[model samples]
Target: MKKEDLKKLHSSIEANFKLLEPFRKNRLEVIKEYVGSHFSDHGSEKQLPFNMIRLFVDIFTRRLVANNPSSLVTTKPLRLRPSAATLQLGLNHLIEEIDLQRDLETAVKDALFSVGMVKVGLNHSASVEIGGVLHDVGQPFMNAVELDNFVCDMSVSRWEDMTFIGDRYRVDLEFAQTKMFVGSEDAKKLTATGKAVQDNERHSTKELLEKRTGFDAEEYRPKVELWDLWLPLENKVITIAAGQLTDVVLNEIDWDGPELGPYHQLGMAEVPGSVMPLPPIASHRDLHELVNFTARKIQRQIHRQKEILGVASGGEGDIDRIMNSDDGDVIKLDHPDLVKDFKLGGVDSLNLATMVNFMELFKQMSGNLDSIGGLGPQSDTLGQDKMIADSSSVQVADMAARVTKFTARIVRDLAFYLFEDPLINLPLVKRVPGVEGVEIPVTLTAADREGDFLDYNFDIDPVSMSHKTPGGQLNKLMTVIQQVYAPLRPVFQSQGITLDTSQLIRSLAQYADLPELDGLFISDDGEALLDDQPVGSHERTLDPNTTRTNIRINRPGATNSDRANAFVQGLLGQGNDEQRAVAARATG
Candidate 1:
């Protein structure tokens, strides 16, 4: 990289950062609501800030957890084959191994707080050791980049049309010299381009803090600003030193990672005619201010003491004594009408009512946070309340969908890292689809994964990504059992296809959100069993030396319904054998 080129890159980076000043300020304001910052108008005392922004964002974050791989992202094979099935299983386990859910929680909070953007990148040289030998392991990581630390082309209207994106971060001077620039000879002699250098003592973060937060860090040790600019057209990433060092090129490397240069952008609301996005909180800013202002006003109104005056007709001694009188204290007056007390009202009920209205409006505008949280005024019946919750979930659903799409893109990059590497090999297990108590161990080698990267379609299970309570899961399961299975079971039985209850349990347990219920049947030994099998069962008959048990026939005593009715009786040791078994299973 030439010094002149480095100068141009540095200038472009600074200009882009300057273009994002308004967005950065907006983010800082929202962050203040999160951390509870003092207002400029308020005095030295920190006035209580109504953080409805934090409240809503946090609630929505809890609602957006990708609790499982099926919830995060799914890879669908273009061609239906055994290889593709194996590949899909590998990808699913990879999602868990990487702990994408936890990273996404961190990223989702950042997106809600800022302009709603998350970046995905691969770290190829992550340090690990095997038998005392250090190895560089490749892995993908996601970042919720700070608003002030990132810059993009402002002239572009679409993300795809944007020329470049860059990240700016502070690096310790000693670390940069000893670690980053140790092997490079350019550190000894700095090349100077014909360009003015930015002041080493100042950066936007420090300046923004001093201006907005009134905090000074002048005594802190100096650090260097490092810039990583990704050029999509060239498919390369370049690093440069900012601050005191003007137009100093650090390093440049080819980016064979994602086509868009290892960085992906995600946002909630779309901003017309701009590549940048409008955060959901930005829309709620005005309402948030109104709420806080009214709350403060109401607080002051209630805290104010009532004014009382005494009209004295005679000596003022009695008036003073009467004004300062405690309980059971009596004051001697010269005349009966010596002093008259006049009291004024302290607070108005109207102010408090208005404040409540403002808060309600804030919640309504921000996707009815109160209703979603099961608080405030709700519908008369359970169904109506559910309807209201469903209606309010629309906005939160949209946010979650955006996260799902963002996660899909990240998963693609992660898959690329795994499939593209010929050296990557993984030992995995895939459960047989219809077979009960069966999982086959398989190994996926580079040869198995070698193919066009576009062979799989990426999908995100939006419904799964949205969290549900245990009660909700149970309700859903019951609905499926009653509405679908119950109606179709007889029809299938007539066609000589009897429903396998054990298989049904295993399949449902694999995907159901109820972990405790699944644990009841899926034992610690990795074997799934609803109950013990009788003698001469298929599992026991597999042993050639095992003797076959004689079959015995008996008259049917009670139907399933009768046994169900007798379950309680069986618990009291008064019912038949079948009813007792049913009761035991129920209790177990």
Candidate 2:
């Protein structure tokens, strides 16, 4: 890490921040309008600006994000190979081996920061008063569309516990403010090199640094909390300064940006389409204004609905007399001929129609009508509803997939760092078809760290992706089941073939996301079914909870054929006696 290198990253910060001027300005207006309180009242005395429309879209944006990860990044084990066996027994072992889910979740969050951190250094230790008060949990989280907001004063989410350097002193992720828009140039430079840049005037970092050196303080600045002032200097030296008020470079290293890029900011996905870095929020400003005007007009009409009278001259008492609420009230006027009357505003269906037209136009312009669907069950066909619900999920998943590439790359490079350590110890796992799993104690060699030793990949979870509740997983499951397994079913059964239920469950889990799928021969408490015996004396019920409980049965004695038969029986039981008789005869 050279001073020139740190300076290069700083230069990138400045150039990128300057370039983001338009996006920064535009995002403020969008979020402002979305929050429904930041608009002008158009100089009118009647200030009735309805924010219903913007609020709807605001919630919609978050819903899009909340809908993301489950579909956008499948929880199914992110494998080292695409076609690897789930039954390999060692695959799940590999997931535990790599600590995939926990690390990857945080990594995804960091990747998000990296995108913003590249242009505007991320505020790792930053926290507002409201802290984790999320905009909308219903919407997607860490969405790329909200990237502009993250760069500005908008407090979006960040990855927690993401440190790239070695453990003892390295703090990967911290809460800090983005110095690109709000802090000093030196602070911004400090931030570019993966430091937690913050408003140092208020923290204990200054005292800690000074106290460490046991020097009387005068010439120093407060750095971020829990962080030593690690600086990269021009002579290709990176140092961890340990003094309070002076630079005492403790440890320095010679390193390139490439080695650190993956470790530091491995994942950050940028919002797509030009104007580059301009979010979808940029397009909705005009539409918000339009809706604002429409609301104002509606409010004006309400005010005008009251009868207004004018005269050549009238006192306050006279006006009050005219405004009397009595059913049979009369008022005296000196100038009868001078009296002028104005009634309520006329019915303008055209304005209402115009507002609807504008709304449609806005949706079309923004291309966000994917969330709008028919209210009645008959309004949209099943396929049409599924298409509408899954469209955004699909698009969002694809966008995140791009970010996954960087994450994979960073995780790959981390192998060299982790494996090179003498203390490193990981089980060497190998898959053998039709064989028992074995773990061999293995030590890393220099050769294993030199090349692309791992080939990990990602796939989106389409099954867990749909926007609707209850039916999303089922919908996707049914679809893939119909396409992939339905045709194979008759053929397999006719040829006396069978499918591995666990393997099928794993494959379908990518699309179905059924919690019940994990219940295969396992109790609700997660104990093996074979290990459990029913305690009939515990809580006996004279009446069954169902017409029959066969398909629902998962006690110790139930077998695959019994489950299948129970499902068929339950279907027949749902019908009348005649149907049941026919079913019984057919089965016999």
Candidate 3:
């Protein structure tokens, strides 16, 4: 790349960012609202009574990222099924390989508070230790990018619709030399760039840091600012240091990753005719202010004490004794009637009511129910409380759907990386079917994913993503079975596809998050076996003519009597010796 071409590209990016100044201003204001007046230059006397924005944002993030969403990968062709499992296992490994949950929570918080967009990309190491040997490693990553750091045209409404995207960030001078611009002539210019941008506080990153920590963090660690420009049409990515070496190209390479460029922008709310999604904090900023104002007024009233001493004629100094009197102190006034108790008005009942109403209104507006925030039950009756919870779940479901879609896209991108990146060869542990707690190591290499990765469909299991106890998950699964599977069973049978009861049980256990119940029954010689044993273990044979053993089942939500019966059956030699001994000890 020539110096003139680099300068031209730099000017183009600057002009593009200038066009987005209005949106940037709005995002900054929203961030300020979230920070509130708690850290303003004003003295401690004018501190905010309460920060409703922060509270609501916290609630929103907690509700959205309550659980790490799981991905479901499957292919249409039977040949690709194994590949799909490989992809799924790779994703599961990736979740733990990186702190994916923390990154997701950070992204959710970023979307809720700062900007409505998040950047998801692939992070890889040039070399890593694999089996005590140096090898390369790669995996998908997500980050909460500042609005100013993310550069794209605001006219496009979707990331897929955009022609180009760019990410602007700063890296340490040493990192720039070793990792980013390595073996390139541009690496020598990093120090110049760092020195030039050391005192530059024009970027939002510096400004936001100052607003948050009340210090210029830029001086703490000198770094070189760089912009990675991606042109989807040309399948190219260009990197350059932004400040002093803006006309010097650091690195340029052809992009072979996902076609949509590396960044995927996600938001909770969508705006028409624009790419900038509205932050959740931006929607109710005024209501937040109103709530704080009302609470501040109430606090001021509480702090104000007005008590006067009413007296008759010539009693100004006579009440000094009363003024200085202590508990159990005997103070005599010149006249007994001189020191009459006269107390003025204090806090108004109306102000208290207004404050309560504002707080409740804020909760209602943001869909942060009392139960959602763990503030205790809101209604008198249990049924009414459930009804309120159900109503709030509608909004929660909508938000969850949006998050689910966002997570699915990320999974899809990860799948592509797993297919294309040669550095990713993950050894995953796979559970064996019909065997409880049995796992085997499986290796997935680039050779396994040989075809187009886009052929396989990737999605997030919403039930898995939701924060639910085992019992709640069981109830949800029961509802799905009763409402969906039961009715469709006949249709499936009509198509000569009989339900596999064992597989069904396995799926139920998986969805209920009860891994202990996985592979509860293993079949052998045309007979279903329990605990890898013959039917005789339960005092019954495989003979159809013989009477079956009477087994008591203790399902979820079972009555105490049912549980007791199951326990007694176990004690009466219905289970293995180990189980019987445990049951005997429990009974004792």
Candidate 4:
């Protein structure tokens, strides 16, 4: 790089910092205050226990993510018929490869709490997909610590994918820095990045490295982004080898990662906020305060009524003079009629009941009490028919639908990410149906890559059996099992579909809350299951009638491993580490 260009880069970086000053001042600073004052309180005084808003939000989020009957699953974009056995088998294998349930649970909870969440993944090297997570929308622009550092451009008011890319790409750069410290490491191996020049409060990395290592250290700016270094050059085109494009800023380079521009950082299901920008919980705050304040006032009034006192005869502090007798020690009463006891009112007796009614009102506002209320007082003695007639169940179903849609989106995004930079890159075998020994290599054909990887699409849906309710799901499954028991068995057998009773039992165990019942998931074919089989034993099972084939693509003997290559690069430092690992691989 030329000296003039280097100077220009420094000036550009300074100007960008100046542009970010407004966003930091307006939005970021205000959000920090909101989190501190309302959300977090570390002081001696805390809010009342019956903060109904917080409690309801917590309960609602838990119900969505915990022991949920509806969860995310993956399938081919185009629905394949049951007769298309090859594609169905391949798709099932892909779904089994990823931990879709756990990942989506985290994403949903994070989005519900923070109103948004930004998900970023590591390159294919790490078997663990999601590398980092940021729940706070403001933190992504201010204090991001993802694999690569990126600040959201604050020039726009409403956040959208279109606001981030195309002609507006320069807006992101107007706040980005070239010579920036993307992340940090420990002081032992690598030091924190401070100001490049020696200032009053900051020291250079070169100086710190020499002091720690007792050796001279060289310094230079990293112009190219970290992901660019790993790209494999092909026909003069630098093919990206890392994760997706949004992981890096790409402020100085043209984005060549299939035009996948700024993604939806905020995935949410809750109704958006209002008034000084707070969560949906904010709407319930006023009612909670009312209940708290009224209860405290009523308690004080009740204490006053319990006291033994008389209107003092023009005395302010005469309580010490009027000492009463107790424990067989007595003071003679001159005039009993002169002393008086405080009296209570009829309304005072109803204070607690009134407060209880107010709390119920709050519940009604949130639609929590709607089920009982909608059934009407006369209909209380009725049967389960009222459960479907009430508006409460309808509202619950709508909320569940939104959450289910969000979970499906997260799984779909992760599937696309995997297809873009596939971790399982080795060859897999597909069995030839009628042939005894012949096998076909499973690989993406040219048709799969004809549209710049756009055609490699997948469909997703929530894992619910006709209903999102657990009992509803369990009953449905049980009914199907009963229908298939005596009649559908031989019908499926004739069609070469081996109906595994063990699989059905495991599903039954989940709804029954019987974890021990999973042990009984044994095959009727006189063979142990794959999961129950010992680690060292052969997994191959011989069923003369079964023609299904399962194949895995990974390093040799990697079946023992959870997944091959968990790239813990930070553990292996830069210099001589790669060479040593390569040597170890060769000699071992």
Candidate 5:
């Protein structure tokens, strides 16, 4: 507006272009050329006002391009000229020898029609080629006052007698006039700033059109034919998702050296020792970050599936169940049962905990990235590394496989216990206390038992298991157990005791083909199968002697049943022969 202000604006524009330079090349130069050619008119003074208008258009166009370059095509500079009405009036005033109002009007109308065509064509071309809809749309408003005056004059009663204006010109004039007329109403509507009034107007317009035509206005509404320049919605979504994931991964892995420390401060600290050493750091933070990122993505996918299933089932679902499950309940140290039930061990639990932690870290990182405006090349490079770590399959097959294996292990260790005792079936049985007509019966077979135990155990040592069974036999075994025991495991695990191999074998013996007890042993050692079936087994045994007899105990004891029963009275009488014999035996 003023010389100083204009200079400031120009400088601001240059700075903005510099800031955006990394995204593209010479954008600022192109913008400057456009503004100079259209507004300054190759150093001419005659079209200064018109040049100013052009400069405004160029600035807006460049901004739109910077925000999203795919929307508009770059083109040769436009030639600015006088509007049709201006040109027609000048021609008539300069060249006429006689009164030629009627002819002059016709010429004006034709010129206006030609100008409209040129403007519309340019607008459409830019939208289709370079994405200039906003720019061209803004242009028509520059001559709004003149166009409205011309249309109003044409619409006057006496003007009806004049038919010299060609059909094409007449149609163009009518369209422009109608649009301008409606725009005036729209301006008033916008001023209200009330949502109710806006909504009423929208509905009123539709109703009015429907009443006049006996058809819905929406039925005939024009479809927006978006030009090729605009990116598809799907593509944008994918790009955003990828960038977000990449940024999250980078932050989670803490790829930037000493930046991982508290407050990102780096320096030597005083120590009592003779020498002070730097904190140990990972050599390849990027590599570790990539692994963590891929793992988190996989974890998210699994949870997402669980969430979807929960929604589909019309219940609070598994996620809610897990959250509300007794596992969350605080237990006293005196509550041995609760303590035993909640204990989670081995690699499966550790891996799951790690995955959950990583996912949360990634989420926090994503938030930070969003706050900073978005991911850039640095983030994408990190994402590429993560992709490689998880395998280069865009389909996420590798991730899916990892999830499947992990899920199988969970099912085996937790679910196999449903087969131990009929009481364990309570966890698997689904029933609404008052509404239920029949309770679902869940049963687990021996093969299911063995498969689950093996799976759970193997998953605890995946690297070793993978080496032992490179053919994926262990994975297959785990999968089968998962499938068969899935319906029953949740029920049993809910009751506290883990479903081990003994429980599975016992459950299978009830309803399905029972394999030989000897076959269940992977080793030929003479250890009793039930007692020596590892610590995770349902039953344990003890060796009997001639002086003492073995008795089955409710819970496994330190020495099984081989020791004389201390709870028994008179068994250790001081002088009785039998008591003396027992006392000597106990002392021995």
Candidate 6:
């Protein structure tokens, strides 16, 4: 048939099927009542036509027997007549009296087959018509709720069930085959040539088996081989071959495959399964390359350790010089210039190296200051542009002093931790080079050096010298020391080191200078002098031993002995003998 004619026929069938859908429930009721009446014995009271009765019987019998319904126990002939009471009630009471002449089963089957036709025509058109016709023969079994339940439980639908239905009904001489060959409109078209009609039926049966069972006798070659095949093959050979060819074509044009070169082979072989390499070494590479990488890593670690130790030991100037070097210029803390040295390395390695470099840079920067309170020369510029900048020199000086004190304390503590027995000891001078060992002679000259002169200059109190010592700077130094060392405890703990601040404080106190206060008094008639003369005298005295008494006392209050003696003599020479006796008692 021409494509246009087939298309027109399909459209008409689809329209009729839509109109028939609304009457399906009514038709089913009529057929059930008609079949029920067949068991009754009166022909005049028949509610349905004889032909309609035969058609209903044929369809129901095929469906029931094909479905193997053990539950339907009765084999009574279906009655076409209604009882007298049914007739007296009304024509409506006789359910089969309604003109339910519409072929609902055929309509539904045609609709399903049309869907199959469209699918097959667009994809594989060789077996389209026959496959379309047989697509929904299983629908009648599905209409039975019990059969539907069984199929649903088995999870088998589609062509598998259709093939089962065909096998069960033995469709060769069935009413379905008869309807397809004699009653169908397509069959009528093929009647122009009798042989063509016969060939069409034979071809239709073969196509049905192939669609439902996936067997193609023509391709399998031997006719005997067809009989040996299973009832339902997994897939037809044509479909499977088409899929395999498509897959091969897709794989051949894929650009991800290796090229025909040694480099391609090497590159493909080295490609790592994981995006990132494993620890110790990740990624696929030669053992020599991995070893070289490890060696470089160790070298870097050693270099960093040396740099850290230099900073800690007051080599800050050296660190500053190195940081300003060309190599250090490229070695940034955020984005290191590893690319300048290593030609091939990941961005991740550069980032990691930058972090390590920055950590070291921060350590060096912090280590340059003696204490946390000690600011860099540029620190004054930090907030100087602000309106409320703290430009007080006195405050800055005080802060600097505190920082010095705190730093001294931390240094003392570090020294004790490093050298003292039992982990820590009392604070003591650790003998830092070039600063604490300088000493100068302290001498006191006599101011009086004459006859009976006292050496008052010989006793310069040592306790008073402490106030002049740097010990007075301790308060400020202690504050700064605490501030600097406060952040060091966590680092020390991580390193398994313990610092004893109490011991450090005690040691600092020992070196700290604290002064004492003293008072002196002098009561002498003779002049006090040094080198046998008074401080004002330039010439030598003529009578160096002529009773030039000089008495100097070292107390708050003193009275001259000559004055006391004169007072006693005056009281002794008072008015009368009785007065003299009283004066003597007072003198005593």
TM-score of the candidate numbered 3? 0.73
Q: How many clashes show up per model?
A: 0, 29, 0, 0, 16, 20
Best by lDDT: 3
Task: Spell out the clash pairs found in candidate 3.
Answer: none
Prediction 2 TM-score vs. true: 0.45
lDDT of 3 at 44: 27
Tens-digit per-residue lDDT, 107-220, candidate 6:
222221111001111112122123213322111101111110011101232322321111001122222223433344322222111112222112222222222223323332
Clash total of candidate 1: 0
Ranking by TM-score: 3, 1, 4, 2, 5, 6
- The residue pairs that clash in candidate 1, if any, are none
Model 5 agreement with the true structure over 1-588: per-residue lDDT tens digits: 234633443344234323323212222222232233344323221222222223223222221112100111111223211121222222222212112222222222222111110111112112121111232221111111111111111221332232111100111222222332243322221111111222221222222222233322433331111101101211110000110111111101111111111110111121233121121111222222443455555455555542212122333333454445584675333323222122222223334434444333432332221111111211224343344333322222332243234323322222222222222212133344545367754333232232212222212222221212223344455666778655565565677545466545544543344546535644346554444454345432223332656774342122101122221213323245543344244221
lDDT comparing candidate 5 with the true structure? 0.26
- Best prediction by TM-score: 3
- Candidate 6 clash total? 20
Residue 14 shift from truth in candidate 3, angstroms:
1.4
State the lDDT of candidate 3 residue by residue for 1-588, as single tens digits.
677866776777777777776766666666566665555542123344667777877777777776776879888888889778878888877766655566677677777764545555565566532111232345566555666676775556766676667877766666677675668866875763433332332336335434433232446665666777787776888877775677677877888877666676667777787777777777677777786777778777777857776888778767777778888998767788665777666666666555556666777787745556655554445565678778877867777778778777776776677677775567888888866679988888877774587688888787765566666666677877679866686575577555455555655677666667644655555454323442124332234455658876532233222233345455344656544444344211
Q: For residues 100-184, could you state the per-residue lDDT of candidate 4 as single tens digits?
A: 4455454444343343333322232212111222222111111112211223323444443222211010111111231122231
* Candidate 3: regions farther than 4 A off: 1-5, 36-46, 123-136, 155-158, 192-221, 314-334, 469-588
At residue 475, give the lDDT of candidate 4.
76
Model 5 CA lDDT for position 36: 38
Global lDDT of each candidate: 0.63, 0.37, 0.65, 0.38, 0.26, 0.25
